[model samples]
Target: EAATATATAAAGDDGGGAWRVVGGDASADGGESPTRGDASRLSRAVDVWSLGCVLYGVLDADEHPYGSWFEREVNVINGKRNLDRIKHLPEAHALITALIEEAPTARPSAVEALEHPFFWPDARRLQFIQEVSDRLDKITVDNPMLDSLEGRSSAVFGHRGWQVVLKPSLLEDAGKHRYYRPHSVRDLLRLIRNKRHHYRELAKPLQLELGDNAGAFYRYFAHPSRFPGLLMAVYAFATEYLAHEPLFAGYLGPETARRYAADAKERCASAGASEEDMLAAEEAARAAALLSGDTLQETRREWFPREDAWGDAARFSVSSAAAAREAAGALGSAAGLPPVGGPAGAAAA
Candidate 1:
């Protein structure tokens, strides 16, 4: 996944070769580059704008708002204020323009990005975003994809183009139109339906955030061990250290935490470990870590996914050898010391 992400980024950069070049003629006939003329150094800003275009393209399946190529150029020249050009904007189109502004200084910083009007208008609106968040959560895999397909299969294939490998079937169908491998009508229907289904499954449960500019959470997920592993590590820490009640409420939510605590308690009962035993285990581990000369707690802290992102260092109590192994494995590492081997063993050390 990491390799794929790096390759994709490189592809993105390379495909926009005219973007990197300093000068050309913006006013000239049919120059592909946006920064061809005056303010060419401001091309970096065009990259930001193209990023917005790419985001919209993915979200809406590569439909340009402008009706035609000429219309697109006109809108770009007028800074895209023409309502006819963007009549279908679902949210603030101004925000998109803000990020894609031809002027570099007009763009927002990474940190200030989260607070953009495009995110939510005000604190109250932001709080209301929980509603948008919920509705977004409810947006199934089918909705967007189903909406994107408007019986335009032939046009889609024409636009995207198709490739076929040289194969025995081609030789067998030689001199016939079948040799060229045009998709059957049934094939096109099946292809569109399958794509819609695939994208629907792909987009569910995702969240988007704005930073330095804006991108979706799924973008980070595309990179290996970048965000999901970090999230899991934090979740593991919350379970290991904090009392179940407070830990659940603080990390997840009050309602969720309470439900989980009840679940955990039930699991404890089923396992024959009394509440007293659990408390005793926690207390003993905390004490042993504090009294010992070694920074056992810091060793555990290294398991956190985004430990480097946290400003302050935090610690975990040294557990039994088995418990330590469990912790290590949960954070996607191998178990090291045994839980009952020796003085260093986790057996309630």
Candidate 2:
């Protein structure tokens, strides 16, 4: 019976009893996990691929490892994967790449996969990220309030062509006419750091008379070690952090830091600030926009996905990945995934 099953598993019809993953876009989907490989088939390679998908989910934070189910299938059919997203973690990229090789014969068996070196923790890798984070933390700039950073315009950016709006959840009826990619921990850390720079304009008012150590918390944003109490504030009250940046952009801090802080508070109050961050501090508020120079956090490119201006109804469907793949090879390629055959030493590939 075992021998019979083993021989039959390899050449099953194109999708005969083959498991199919089912789900929606996960970047902004907030609910139960939106993707899973159905176990309708008994192929060992299928099991291995499923394992790889699950692992991808685990590591990529809230992101669907290969995006939606249809996206994963198209990649599988073409011997490709969104491995570039995982490339940051070399071990994960290698293991998943191997496990999902298009050829069943090329994939590792369950026993073989469990023992792969990628599973082992690499202290060197940890240290390297630490080094990167540390180096990035030391970076400094002048007058973030005066800077003109270009980013995916927020909801506050005035619902123009494809703005990147951050909302809490994705209800089925909600108009999700947008493309999204989940942010990484490093990205969050970078945001924290940027907030310290740009959002600190709000905090500028009270820095002086507050105390000698008033602005001491300025630079300690997201260092791997010695993370400050302010981090918890950012984490716990993140909604405020999200709201402040967009609203502050509307204000021009032309007067004293105190005056600017006061003016900013009234303006931001209309923009929905929680009044927890810079607006709450007198000195920080006063300094919010004293700069006649470049305003904070300006950039040339938008980092996150913007709203799809067309807002085509088809773009938001669960079946859309396959449809898009079949149409213009759009979804996965548009996803910016790395090409296949990354890393080395799989159970087979």
Candidate 3:
């Protein structure tokens, strides 16, 4: 059994003092250090909290995440974090919030912390969108994942029409995919599914033409206001998915697959599986995941030319009429229909 110690700090003028660690060795100055077993049990969580504080200080110009020193421990105990200064940085703000969770179990481990969206590159962010879109395609209307996505989407895009946030030319392109009215997040998801399916079916020339405008398309979801939630939602889903289906985790990335595979191997050993059988199972899992293909990676390569392109412009630059005309021409050439502004197109108009 590990001994428990209490540390006390001088009370403020109001007679309040900081909180103390519960399991540690007594110290002369009233500080405490955890004993071996206690350290193993508590250090990771305590370290996460400390790191959160350090991150908050660094990001917010040395401002504490909790309030003043007198009230800091109390605020922390009450789950009151002073995150105002870091709100402008949504990913960092979210990471700090999770890191400083009052429940030790709720705080992410160090490995998970490094995997947070705050550290993701633009390409990974784009891959997240692709994965979410693919997953949305397979889920039913009543799926709980839909509810999660809906709540997040509503927070950012509101319950009203998404057209307000989208460019007219983008909407026009959506119309070409038979998605004329995107009234909600579900509607937006449907539009994405339709467009991606159509993009896959398009001739090389048409695909290239539309792919050139992929940045414009991505802007609707990746806008500054919506991106943080997008990243978080995908992260949440991926975490859940990885836990349940570690075997197919290759869809996320090779590194993630390798990590999950190690865990799976341990589970197999615990279950008393033979080494040969475990190796065979691992090979089969890898083969299945490979056969399924990684839609996100494929979409990322086809759509985004460079990571920098994601942030090069605040808005999609092409005019509505020009974009519509160019897209229509590309589709027309691919499908053997008359070009935009030609006699047949003029007659139809």
Instruction: Point to the candidate with the largest lDDT.
Output: 3
Over 1-349, each residue of candidate 3 has an lDDT whose tens digit, in order, gives 0000100111111223222332232222334444677445456767776777777777876667776776765665456767988766767988898877766556677776776678776555655566556544433344454555566665445566567765566566677656444444556656655665566665565455446455544543666654435556555545443323432353444544444555544543343332343344344333322321232233323323444222221112333334433443454455454444544334333
- For candidate 1, write residues 184-234 as lDDT tens digits: 222322322232233333323221111111223222321232222222222
Those runs of model 2 whose alpha carbons end farther than 4 Å from true positions after fitting are: 1-42, 121-349
lDDT of 2 at 347: 12
TM-score of predicted structure 3: 0.55
lDDT of 1: 0.35
Top TM-score model: 3
**Clash number for model 2?**
25
Q: Per-model C-alpha lDDT, please?
A: 0.35, 0.34, 0.51
CA lDDT of 134 in candidate 2? Answer: 33
Task: Report the poorest 10 consecutive residues by lDDT, candidate 3.
Answer: 1-10
Give the TM-scores of the predictions, in the order they appear. Answer: 0.22, 0.25, 0.55
